[model samples]
Every structure is written in structure tokens, then in C-alpha cells.
Target chain A: MSITVQGRQAATTAAPAPPGGRSRGPARVRWAAVAFVAPAWLYVAGFYLYPLASSIRMGFQDYTVSSFYTGVAPYVGWDNYSKVLHDGHFGETVLNTVLFTAGSLAFQFAIGLALAVFFSRRFPLGGPLRSLLLVPWLLPLVVSGTAWRWILDTDSGVLNHVLLNVHLIAHPVPWLASTHDSLTAVTLVNIWVGIPFNMVILYGGLQSIPGELYEAASLDGAGGWQRFRHITLPLLRPVTAVVLTLGLIYTVKVFDVIMILTQGGPAGSSQTLTTFAYNLSFQQLEFGRGAAVGNLLIGVAVVFAVVYLRATREQRQAGR
Target chain B: MSRLLRTSRLFRPAARPGALAALAAAGALTLAACGTGSGSGGSGGAPDTLTEIDYYDAAPQNTQLPQILDECGVRNGVKIKHQQVPRAQFMPKLLQQASARSLPDLALIDNPDLQQVAATGGLVSLSKAGLSTEGLYPSIAQAGQYQGQTYGIAPGVNGLALYYNTDFFTRAGLEPPTTWAELAADAKKLTQGPRYGVAFSAVGTEEGTFQFEPFFWTARGNLKELDSPQAVKALTLWKDLVGSGSASKSVVTWTQADVNDQFMAGNAAMMVNGPWQLPTLNADKKLHFGVVPIPVPSPDAKPVTPLGGEVWTVGHSKPAREAKAVAVVKCLLSQDESAKWSKDAGYIPSNQRAAAQLASADPQLAAFVQEVGTAKARTTELGTAYPKVSQALADAIQAVLAGGTSPGSALSQAQSAAKN
Candidate 1:
């Protein structure tokens, strides 16, 4: 399967030998390849790597609002990290971050995978219907979050209105107002924002898996559930890895949606690490602490990425 | 996946190791660029044009500032380019500009934050640039002075006042409250069915803290001693209102704008808000509202509201450009112009003479003018330390109002946060 071939390409011992006839042009082609990727590399170095290094450097310094102008921040070594770790809100924020990530990822993936499988079934206007599902993904998060805020407003929100009308509860739910429910409300909104992304990615992965494999499974007298369990799940592993890894990265760093909704508030109940870092840097004017939190967020992303790659590598070895 | 990848590819592809490296590099460069390239700078010359920036990104002021600035620009013989950023982004953007050594020759900063920015040694003291703070309200003048140096000067100033629904009050047959006991009793009596008797932001932001300042200071509470008995009394009044179901529990999350919305919708009988919301309130013709100074802890206690307005100051520049920038600022704040802006923009004038002339003529701003006379500069006592304390106070407000924490404990906790 090309999926396995694509997966195995990473584990190759050395660069694949050029076709025998191409030897005369290898040097020119090599230079041309370098030329093709050079702009991307330059863009990368100029934009991303430099600022990241600066942030990492700033993480060790006592950066502040004054530092923004003076360009001087005394090196504080691990002081910022230690201060952040010992912060009163740190434990709750970290626990909230974990809960937010896990809740958002689980639902986003499940709903996305389900929709991907559902849409993979041929139907009238299937293409248009699938395209239509991308609206939530297209709307700016600020716009969506604002709209949701109105809908979830405890006093006049339409969500509470509908629920009350239907006798769902005796009183309105304080979606953004109550600290107890604020995290759940934020997570739900995040999940809604993420499902479209998951659906689209998993749907593409479903498409890449050839139909003949399913047909072969059917010929072996496998039932619908049996075929899906045996063939679809196994073959879609590469795509699942792609969806999950990307989802983990995105979910762990969700900020704007939360910021627009709660601002890590009602006494910092809904704060995630991203908002905490932002609050420290921008709101508190403590850039060093913000940078430390930001570095820790990157550490989280790295751990997830490593796990994803390790699983991919194991699958590749199994294929071999 | 192809559909998603196709769109993702258009913007950013999924970050593999190489892509992650590229992503970081791209992000770093774009972020760095925000602080690089002297976005606005004045070199050593009699420049024909001077860049100016402010946070007047809302109506009346946003539309009014440019015309006023241009008139000043014309008088000073320099074309002024004004940039209005979102109010929230104003400080961060200014700091970025300052860091890049590209601060505009002319800038308008919120009065309370001027001290913090001035302390950075980025602002050119206006006194050094031939601008006078004379004829300004004492408290308003205090906002522009950091230590002994005057770094900013306002054309106009504003303060919080009570905006009560006339219809609601008339129906309840109650006069506007002048003391804390009356306020609490009237608030409880007026609150009925769907309407909250009073609304004020206790949101976890500067706006919340700004709204709380009137009550806090009126009770003779100081930011440095937030855990004092007087401060606790001030917070308890708000807690009682919410606890008695006289105000919405959601006030902890409401901005002044939100509070105004509630008042306009008849959901709130009264609100503590600034004159900046006056234009919007005036737009709703059916909303019969009356303005009064915020009620004090007692009839004899003085009401001390926080000063609200942006002060125009010159950024770091060579003498030639600084002279021109200062000239423009002067023209913007001249006696006639200050009065004109105060009238046109519905803000209280900083020029006390202009303010007095208007106070008798424009009854709508009379209460605010009275309040601005004694309005305290939030940073006057705490100086640059005010923002931190303001932040802590705002959080304490949230804890007390929303989290149901006791006022005493919350204030003490916030007081410690401020010290740290």
C-alpha cells in the first residue's frame, strides 16, 4: 500500500539512488533542488527561528514593559520558571489545560472520524454537503466566539432560552459567568471549532485509502462492522496519527476562543497555559514569565510530536 | 484529508520536523518585524510631517480626533498622520513602537497609564517642550506629572457618574441615592422581576477597577491599603447588591459597555459608567436617564472618581521635531480648543475655565464636570505601581462578586499580589 510506502520513506538508510540513466544530471538536479527550497528556508530562518531564539533568550531574562524599550533585561537564569511553577494559580491552570486538551481532543476526533466515515458514503450532493461543513472552520474565531457568547449569555442567551422553553432546566446555566461551568463551556466551544478540521482531514485520509481493499474484505464474507474494524481502521492509521498529532498540537495551545469567552477569569478558573502566558506577558507586563510559560507550552507540543512519530515508526517497522 | 490538506496548504501545511522549523522561523520573523523597522520615527530635522497615534478607536473621538489633530497640524505647519489602534492594543503597540525606536512624534495615552509609560524614559516631558499645565483641573494635572516632571497634558478629562433610569426611579417614587444606605435600600426596592436595580462592571480588567474607584475612594480607601476596613465597606456594598438579587450576578463579567447596554435595555435601573458612553446613551431617545455623582459612603463624604481621558504627549525626538510636536499638542489643548472638544465630544474639559463656562451651559455634563473637579488620578498615589494594584483590585472584585469570596480575604489576597 502507498500508505505503508509513504510511512516507510522516513526510515530509509540513505538517500534513494538516482535512476541509472540520470547519473549525468545528478549534480545539476541537486543544485536545482537546493534552489527550489532555498526561499522557504530563508523565510523560515528570517521569520521563525530568530524570534524563537530571542524568546528563549528572553525567558532567562527579567523582561518587562521597560525592557521592550530599553532592550536590557538582566539575566535571571531559572528564576522565571521557578516563579511560574510556584505561582498560586499554576496548579489549577495546568490541570485546566490538561482537561481542556483531553476533552477537546477526544470529542473532536470521535465526531470528526464519525463524520468522515459518514461522508465517505456516496450520496446525492455529498461533495457539496461536505464542503458546506467547512463554514465553522472558515469563520474567524473571534466572530464565532462572540456569537457563542451571546448565545450562551446567562441572562438573555438563546441557548438558555431554548433550553428553558423546552423545560430542560429550572434555571439558566451560567455558561461564561460561573467558574464551575466556564471551563466546560469553553471546552465545548473549542470542540465545535475543531470538529470541522478533524472531519476534513480524516475524510481525506479515508479517500486516500483505496476502495479495493474494502471490496476484498467483503469478498472474504466479512460483515460491515467486521470490514471496518479489520480493514478501514488498520489502513487509516497513518491518517489517524496525522489527525491526532495535529489536533493535540492545536488543542493544547487554544487561546483566542478562551480569551474571547472568559479571559481566564471568574478568578482564573478557565485559564489554560496559553492564556496564562499571555496574561503574564501582556496583562501583567512580565514578559520573562510569559516566555517561560510559552516555552513550557512548546515542551508539551514536543512531547506529543515525539509520541506521534514513535508510533508512526513502530507501524513502519511492522510493515517492513 | 485531501480537502483539508488543500486548504491547509494554501495557508500553512501540517508541521513536520522541517515544517516546524520553517514555521518557527516564519513566526519569529513576523513577530520580530512587528517590533522592527522604525514604523514611525522623527530624525533630526524640521520635518514637514509628524506621525501621531492614539487609542481613540471609537465613535465621536475617533472621528473627532483627526479633525482636531489636523487643525493643530495645520497651525504647526506639519502634516499629522494619525493612527488609531484598538484601545486594548494601544499600550502594547506603543511599547513595540518604543522598543523599535519608532515612537510617533505625537501620541495620546490613557491618563492613568501615562505614568507607567513615562517611567520607561520613553516620553519627552511636556514641560521641557514649552507646554504649560496651568488652568487644568488639579487632579487632571496630576495625571500628567510623573514624579516632578510633567510628561503628558490632556485637552479634556472624564470621570464616572451615576446614570439612572428616570422612568424606573419615577415608578419606584425614589430620588437618586446620595448615600450608601439610600443606594442599597433603593437598589433593593427597585430591583423587580427581570430588571437589576444597579449594574457596574467588576470584570477582571482595568475597566472593572476603574468603575470601583469611585466607591473605593469615596469610602476613603486607598489602593496601597486595599485590605482596610474602608475598602472592605466599599466592596461589601457591591456584594450586598448582588447578594440581595438587586444586581445581576453577571456584573463580574460585564464591561462598562455591557452595563450601558443593560441600562438601555431596561435590565439595569442604574449604572456606574463614564461620559464616553454618553453619545451612545443619547442615541436611544426613549431611554430617559439622569446623571448624578456616584453616591458616597455618607452624605458628608467626598466622592472621588477616577479620571478618565487620554493625554497627548510628545515621543522621544530631536529638538526640531519635538518643538513642532509640542506645538501641535499645544494647539490641541488651547483654551478654546479644549472647550470645543469638551462640548463636541461630551467629555469634561481639563481647562478649568473652559470647564466652568460649559458646566453652566451644558447641564448634561454638569455632574461629570463637578466630579472631574475632584476626580483623582488613579496613578497619582501608586504611580507606575498602579497598574499592578489595579489588576489585583480587579481580580479581588471578581472573587468577591462572582466567586463569593469574602471582601476582606479577597482584598488581602489582592493586596499581596500587588506587593509582589
Candidate 2:
């Protein structure tokens, strides 16, 4: 390198060389790097970590709106947590959340997979069709929720209007008037919002698979279904795993759809943990109990994240 | 040598005091700008300057109150920024703002939420503000009082009334019943085709509680005494109305708008509605209607109507803001402004003199005024526990009506839940 004395080599070799032949120079560089990252570190510490710590602390207190204003929210040591666990609706909320998440994920993934397959083919209008399909996803959540609400209204909704006009039934459907229908309606709205995301991710995954693998399968006399089964499905397993995990995490925290569409109404049949936590905090002004519910949600999410990370790491190790 | 180099790098960009001073000055200016316009009265002593007041009125913005307020502002020196939040969001938003100590200078507080606000120490006491309750309607003014002090000012009054579609009534050959029993019987007679005999908003909120209050009071029962025999009887009548198919089970989730929609669509013969629906009913030419006091269970019993209205209040945390807020309140409650408000907003004036003046101008409003005398204040305790108690009542009512729970059992549960 000394004989060549090239700029690239000099620049590359300059990093390890130090004045006074001391390793402390590299240590100082490390310190400088930390200093550069300090602002971002402090931001996360203040905004995210501090609030999260405070929320956990508040969960143990007998916090209420009255107490918050009066500055007398005394710590009650597990009382708030106990009260939430003992509540009659807590179990129902958990069950509903799980059902909603599972139901939405299944339908969204299926429809999205179907759309991805349909669009993967070289068609004349594939580009335009794919773009057109994203309208529902492009809509703001509140707008989507409201539009669905109008479509699902028991009396004058478009769905009922169309059904009745076609003589499908003699009566108007109570789309949001019953527990079952309300749940169904909310799930449908969620599925609609989630499908485009699934489609986009799966389409990208589908495009990455080598054409040679499919060609080899075709040369071996593999049928369309066989080619998809052996080649596409096996290759997309990693993408599928990622999609399902991310979708599950997102769907479990579904609140806006429930809140706007049904508001956990028809006797709170559509209530999820997120809405329950919200109602507890904002509606009931029971911040301690709300925080307890929030902590439960965080705990569930952490467990999910851990399981996902473990599975992903194992898969990566196997791949290596 | 490395240490020396590192130390030089660290001190390379030394802090500039002049630049830091400028940054600090900018922050101070921003903070001062944010602080200056806050509170009831502006810090600078300029009485003639327009005081900006934020009012959260649930009245539809397109209707008369906003228009009248705008006109009044031009006539008077004061300026009001009326924000029409949806009815369901108004109280919660107010509560949130109050909690944050970022409440507007003036807010239209619902009567039922007054106690909750007062408990939070968010409202400025009217007595302390040198405002006398002498000119206001006693019962209406009493609605805003909590802990022996007035914290809000009622500009108008509202109560539950029997609104009958004249067309439906005529088609069914039924007259508006004067007693609860007659109303039930008449409702049965009116139940034909797609139209229901009676429509009541049994939704999970104050609407359900307020609508049911008349029935309970007429039966000589109180929400406080939910286990009483009369309470059971009142609950039984509501259940019977739903169970017998005279009233729709859909009312359990129906909002005021739902009831109004059904009534306007001619799907309901008679509905238990409030004064707020008057303007909507008046605007629809095809639907003829009449407003009468809510019927009682027995003819001997007095017709009891649950009182409803909004109250104007200033935030207590900001004393200077209260002065500006009081000015806005005075401007809103002025006789001429109050008359226009009552006329356009479909609310009965709290100013008795304003009511008297308007009563002669509109005969229908005068008839409404006669019913105001019998309007009973909602129980302050129930009003305080409104969020919890109302949901409990709605659930209990729905169970009795839909789930076949006995009224006696349903009422017992309601009482327990309300107390808890």
C-alpha cells in the first residue's frame, strides 16, 4: 500500500492509523459517534420511555379524572389491575378482540392472495387494475368507517336498498342492530382496509421468485396448480409468515373501525381491548384501570413480538 | 496526542452566547404570544376591544342560534366564536379540555355534566362573578348549581314532549293520548303497515335516561328509588310496549336522530322526543305534528317532563379569561338576543321576560312554554353519574324489553348499577 500510495487505499487505511500510536483514538471516535446519536437517544428516552414508565406507574394508582385535577391520585398497589381483571366485560372484550383479529386476518389474507395471483399474470390492464384496487386503502380511515356505516345502516343503507330492490328478501336486514351483525360488519370493514396492504406485500414477494424455478417446474410437466403449489407457495413462505404476523399484530389493536362503525354497541358485542381501554380512560375517566388494560395490551404485543423474533431467527439460521 | 486532538474537536464549535440569547428571546416571544390571548379578559385594558369567546353549542350550525349570534355580535361590541360540536362528542371534548386546563373562555355545558365539571374545579362560580340568578327561570338556573353555588348559566330550557305525526295519527284514526295507558292502547291501534305506534330513543346515554324519567316520575317512582313498586310498574309498561310489538326493539340502539328520521319518514305515529326536534318537524311540510306534554300512567297524576338544556360557563383556572367569558355570557343572555335564540334555536328562553315576549309572537312556542312549568329537574345524583347510570338504565331497559327480564329484576339491577 505504501508503494502504490493510491487515494482509495490511503483513505481506507487512514481509519486504523492514529497519532501517538494509541488505541484511545478509536475509543474517542466511538465516543464521538455516541455524541452524534445523543439527540435521537434523548428524544426516544423522553417521549417514549418516560411516558411508558409513567403509564406503568399509574396502573398501580387509584387514578381518576377527579383525582387527576385535585392532585390526589394515591397509589393503590394492584387494586386497579385487580378491578379490571374482575370486571365482567374484560373476558368478553378479550374474546371479541381475538375473534375479530383472527377473522379479519383470514379473510384479508385469502382475498389479498387471490388478488396477488390474479395481478401476477401479464395482462393488458394489470397496472391500471392494480392501481384501481387501492381506492379503499387510499381512503382515510374515518371516511372508510363512515362509508361502511352508511352502507350497513339497518333501515336506509345501500346494501339493504339493493337487496330489497332485487327481491332478495322481504325485509330490511338489521346490519348493525344485533351483536352478531355488528361484529360481522366491523370485521368486514377491517378486512376491506387490510386487503390492499396484504396484496401489495404479497405481489412484491411473488415478483422476487426466480422465473427459472417456474420454468423448470413447467419443463418437468408440472400443471398450473402444481407449479404454484411446489414453486410459488414454498418460495413465499417467508413473506407469508411476515405478512400474517404483522397483520395479526395490527388487527388485534383494531379500534377505529369498531368505534366508528358500531361503537361497541348493540350491548357492547363488538368491544375490543383497545376500545375498552379508551372508554375506560376517556369515557369513564378511570385512568388507572385504563392503564391496566393498556399494560395488558402491551404485554400481549410483547409476547407476540418475542414469539415472532424467535421464529424469524430460527428460520434465518436454518437458511444460513 | 489523541486526547489533545479529541479535546480540540469537542471545543471546535463553542457555544455562541449571542445566538443562544436570540433563540431564547424567540422562545419567550412564542410563549408570550400563546399566553396573551388566553383567559376570560385580555391582559391589556381595552374594554372596547372585542372579547373572543369559544362556545360549544350542540345546536346545528345551519340553524338560527349561530345566525342570531352573528347578528347579535355585529349589533353588540362583543365577538363570539360558536363551535358546533356533534351532540355525542360535546361533553367528552369539554371534559377533556377541562382536564388539560386548556378550556375555552366560554362553553355550553350540558346540565347533567355540571356536577362532574364542578367536581373537577373547572368551572368558575357564577356567584363569585357577581352575576345574580334573579332574572333566570328558577328550576332552569337550579340545573346549573352544584354544591350550593351556581357554576353555569342556562340560556334556554328543553324537556321531553310527545311528538305525534298528524298524518299517521289520522291514518290510524287515533288521537294523542292524554294518559300513559291510553297512549299504549292508542299506540297498539296505530301499529299497522310499516309504521310503529310509538317511537322512543332507548339508546345507551342520557337520551334513554331522560326519556324514561317522565314515565318513572308519572308512576310516582324515582331513579333513586328504583326498587320501588312504582318503579317496577313503570318499567313493566316500557317492556310491554316493546314486547307487544307496539314499539320497536330497534329503539334500544336508536339515537335522537334515528327517532327523528323515523318520525320524518312517517314510520312512527307518535314518538317521545324533545324540543330540539321541533325545527326539523316544522321544516318538513308533508309531516304535520303537534307537541304536547308527556303523558302520565294515570290521569290523576301530573304529566312529568325531564328538563334538558345547555349552560354557559367560564373556566376557573383562568381568572382573567372569566371576565371576558362573563361579557360573552351577558351578551348571549340579553333579552333581544335571547328572544331571537329561542325563536331560531327551538329552545325555550331562560329569561322569563324573553319567553313572555316570544310567546305572543309564536302561539306554538307559547303552548310549549305552558309545558315548561311542569318540567322537573333531573336528579342531581343521577345527573352526576350520568355516563355510568345512563348506560346501566339503557341496558336494563333493553333487557326488560328484548331479553324478557322482569321489570322488577331489571330495575333492581339498574338501581344497584347506578349506586355502584
Clashes of each: 11, 7
Residues A229-312 of candidate 2: C-alpha lDDT, one tens digit per residue: 898899999889888988888888888888888677665678899988987787666789999999989888888888788778
DockQ of each: 0.27, 0.27
TM-score of chain B of each: 0.90, 0.84
Model 1's lDDT to the true fold? 0.85
lDDT of model 2 at residue A245? 86
Candidate 2 residue lDDT tens string, B10-81:
422333344334444555455445544443354454233332233334445245666666665665565666
lDDT of 1 by residue, B1-420 (tens): 234323334232233456556566666466667654433344566778888888776678788888888888888788988888887778888888877666788888999888878877888988877778887888878889987889999989999999999999998899999998988898998988888889999889898999999999999999899999999999999989988988888887798878988999999998898887888889889999999989988788879999999899888867787788888888988887887787667788898878888889877788998888888899888888888899889889888877779999999989887887
Give per-residue lDDT, candidate 2, residue A87. 74
Question: What DockQ would candidate 1 receive versus the native complex?
Answer: 0.27
| Fnat for candidate 2 (0 to 1) | 0.14
